[model samples]
Target: MSTEVISQIDVDRTRGDFHYPEQHTFDAGTGLSHATIDYISDVKNEPDWIREFRHKALDVFLSKPMPTNWASKDLENIVFENIRYYLANAQRPTRSWDEVPDDVKRTFERLGIPEQERKFLAGVEAQFDSEAVYSNMKKALGDEGVIFVGSTDGLRDHPEIFKKWFGRVIPTGDNKFSALNSAVFSGGSFIYVPPGVKVKHPLQAYFRINAENFGQFERTLIIADEGSEVMYMEGCTAPKFETATLHSAVVELVALKGAKIQYVTVQNWSANVFNLVTKRAVAHEEAEVKWIDCNIGSRLTMKYPGVILKGRKARGEVISIALANNGQHQDTGAKMIHAADETTSNVISKSISIGQGRATYRGQVHIPKHLKGCKNNTECDALLINSTSRTDTYPAITVRGLGNSVQHEASVSQVSAEQIFYMQQRGLTEAQAMSLSVNGFVNDLVREFPMEYSVELKRLIDLEMEGSVG
Candidate 1:
């Protein structure tokens, strides 16, 4: 219960050994150019359309300037010419864990992928650097017409399904980073569920970045057929590096009529990484889509997962939690667009700032005039652990329909010394007390996560809080 004990907890948290020796067989040498894109396309042996798609997206990326108005000035430091766009040890993914390369398997073992798969996951995909080294799904789900594989495999084997929805949700021109992802995206999940089939267990993916001064661009797409239900979860981590790393991904989801799709992400990048991603979903008639996102560590992260209710009675929801430590910035939020009658949406965001860290919430909710009976609710809350810590909230809600209703609420609170003292008197250390208080702040939303993820989230928050106090 002493201050020294709490301080030690902080030290232990940062003592993790995440470094691994680079064992790549191929590297697309540093920089972004037409040649790099063409090489990536040729290496994949992709269809001509896809190869052309990459070229067009590269042009779009070149035309757009780095966004400076809302993002941190750190964005200017990303030297596109110095970052290696692709690095892979193997060309094909292995279905059996034993077949995976020893070093790659060891990396996943450290991340708890195999154990988690053995315990409860319906499927598991592991991506190391720019390639999915391992991918497997439950035979039962496969029998029910579930297709879960890497994007490359999906396009090659099931073009009918993959081609129809690949870039429909989030177009290549959606943003600068999205265009970058489209140009050189290598490893990401591709999921499709048949109509009326409900996946009982969650499908999971783990992405690890092991190389320094490199970029990982994974493109993921999910399509839930009519009356089907599926839950997909992804986790990401990068080893500590002195040089900056880039992680730019694009995820798109499509929920068909009367279907439900839940997408969850637990992103814990190292302090030297820039995590910029674009994720969006579209909900059809009577369908539902939800995004549960948690951002813990990154030098600068700018991500906003969004949903578009495209049909009558569609629904969308976003629950986000962000924690910023010293020398880190967590800029995250959600977007919802109601394009049909009787659509509904909700947004709940929570942030924690500690030791000069900064957190920002930028959200948007819109309902057009033609839509009737649309509804929306948005809440943003922030907790500051130190006077030097800072937080910001920007919620933009636009409702043009007469029968639509929208509500927005925001609050900022700081951890009080008295509360910490009281908890310490109760036999808890300062670190424990702070961790408990911070956990309680987001307990309501954390419970929304699956049991395993919630436990891991709590552990991450505890470690983060340890570093914040004292």
Candidate 2:
């Protein structure tokens, strides 16, 4: 399939220059000590059980050795004692955006959060550094049985619902990073829609990292009740830094019988970040789950959103896009497991690499022997901007059922210098021309995003392409 082209719009190139709040200094002190964990727990007034959970997780993090075989090698350089565990510029989240600290509000305004919320979002949560500062839900949405807020708030206010599902999908012992997130995780979104309720607009959460040696571990859980539908979006940005920051998060989603859920993420971290995240969902009878993920601008990113089709007639789809610029590595894909009859899945992945960057897709699709009528289709495409860049696709598909149908396809291509030379001859500067071609390479998957976000994604791609020409 060809990539979709995005129409050029008048953009405020100056807007990217808007400054954000400085990292809260007092919270910048390092070391993963018991005292630090206690401070975080006390500040949030968390339950005793959670404090103990953090301590247990810290032990696991300290004892566990970094996996040597994974796509990430930079993770070995992380000094556990050199990172700050928690930070908060605001003691509590404000219901009204204006009530948020002026500097914090300015940060969101810089990112166009307010404008996006006003124009298209049903709800918006803004988190800076380590804590959610502003969370607002449209009254009409709140009135219709929707719960949208930070994970901390969810634990405090809705303990019954929150406790039941927290870590249920991805337990602390699932993996090293997942355990770490369970221990010190804070400031993520928890959303639930009542049975049969369908949200008209997307809900979004924006995460910004303002500190130098900080690790942001946010935990998000989304549950769609029977016959319900909900769409959630997440975006991230961090300023340029010399030292790498760690962002390892765990996201779990559950789609009940006849329900649907779509999770979208657009990450544009600076090159000084190791973005390792775990996201998975469970779909019941006749339910559907989709993951739309875009990854760019991180030193190393390892994320593969997965889904388990647990009941008959369930379906899952994952559409992903990644771009790796100089010194960056984008390692991401998806997983689909069929557990019942008549389940279906599809995975479409696209990646672009430039200036010695590397991109890889690692994915799996499994259908057990008892799962009859299972079907799956997988496609992976890679684009190389320069000869020095690299890309790879590794897919493992297992079909055990007699009637299962599975197909896998992969293609890799390099942008011909002729394409750029052609565009340059059309009156476009070299940078603009290369940007247009790279944008064209990934536009089809980006079009799946909301109009506003699609525009932002293209602009970010363009910004990364600047100075890319040799």
Candidate 3:
């Protein structure tokens, strides 16, 4: 119940400044219209059915009104007509990195995509602006029947498999942003693991936005066949622009019977970008799906990764962390829908707000009356670093089935003077003390991240904490 808050915190101003010159082979120009949709479909040479789907989704996006109550009033500022829907430097993805355009390759090089792939990633895909410039998978995994490529490539090479579960998990009309993404979506990963195959290493994709007054919409689909296992990770960053930028992506995951799929995302958009995304998964009988999400460095972000337990004995989990600095709002949480017997779901969310930033958690858990032996647990924690910082939690749970159990817990705490004083007495600078305290508060969750990401997260936190305290 302690409500004390600090006055101010130091913020790093140059963490996301890497930008490359815009080099596009094709551009759809600004605004959203039927002609725009037609231009996009024509550029990609999409099939008639796919083109029709895009037209339908565009109508849905236009007909639906903006959400009134779910997000902050800042949503009113988004000018759809001012955003360039698509930009691409390459028409087709290249299997060799050398074939990638020089400017695009330089951007990824600055982001360390090639280095990461050389060190540990089993496959790597890099998207610049609106289309993937480079995509490559380890030959050994491909020999094992693993399909890792850009979505466009997936549609072109393996339509039979791609069409089977592309929109099955999350329909195009799920939400306004989803519908919009469907209309002008461009580059994202498409992954498929064969039955009984286990990918020994994780696959990764990196998304970069390099255009001004532009919007990046990527559509991703992942399918793990029965008795298969796979892990996919995605990282996104955008250059700083004076005008507003938009990034809205849709990701769908399907884990078949006895399959396991783990999806991880680290989003570090520039402070001028609005990052709104939809990610969901479907777990079949005895299947398992997990989402590890980290959000930081955006003007405003609203994301809620969710899972649907569609078959008996399925399990789903979501672990999330968010950091909101000045001029930022992180509204994030998770959803679990239990439609089968003996299913389980868990959610753990942690957030930190600094300066005038705000963080909110909105979650939902549902168990129908006919489902039996269902279980759910949700925990949300928030930390305040400035007097003007704010945090909120809203959790809704519904259970009507016999032998069903649900638990929810939330807490908001501010940095205490006593802890800072104690650390200062030990010869640490006040800023260092405050940083250490904040790090300790989320240490447990930070350890859950992969080593490289964990190191980077700590560095970001330390930078944000420098000169925060007198």
Q: lDDT of each model, Cα atoms only?
A: 0.92, 0.87, 0.88
Candidate with best lDDT = 1
Q: By TM-score, is 2 or 3 better?
A: 3
Per-candidate TM equals: 0.97, 0.94, 0.95
Give RMSD (Å) of candidate 1 vs. truth: 2.9
Q: How accurate is candidate 2 locally (lDDT)?
A: 0.87
Per-residue lDDT tens digits of candidate 3, residues 48-127? 87889889999999998887767789989999999999998666889988888787777788777999999989999998
Q: Count the backbone clashes (under 3 Å) in each candidate.
A: 0, 1, 0
Tens digits of per-residue lDDT for model 2 on 238-350?
Answer: 77678778999999999999999999899988788889899999999999999999997678999999999999999999999999988989999999989999999999999
Clashing pairs in 2: 4-444
Tens digits of per-residue lDDT, candidate 1, 1-470, equal 69999877644575333767887787888999989988888778889999999999999999999887667899999999989999998778999999998888988887789999999999999999999999999999999999999887888889999899999999999889999999999899999999999999999989889898999999999999999999999998887898999999999999999999999999998899999999999999999999999999789999999999999999999999999999999999999999999999999999999989999999989998988999999999999999999999988888995999999999999999999999999999999999999999999999999999999999999888876666
- What lDDT score is found at residue 280 in candidate 3? 94
Instruction: Name model 1 segments beyond 4 Å from true.
Output: 1-17
Cα RMSD, each candidate: 2.9, 5.0, 5.1
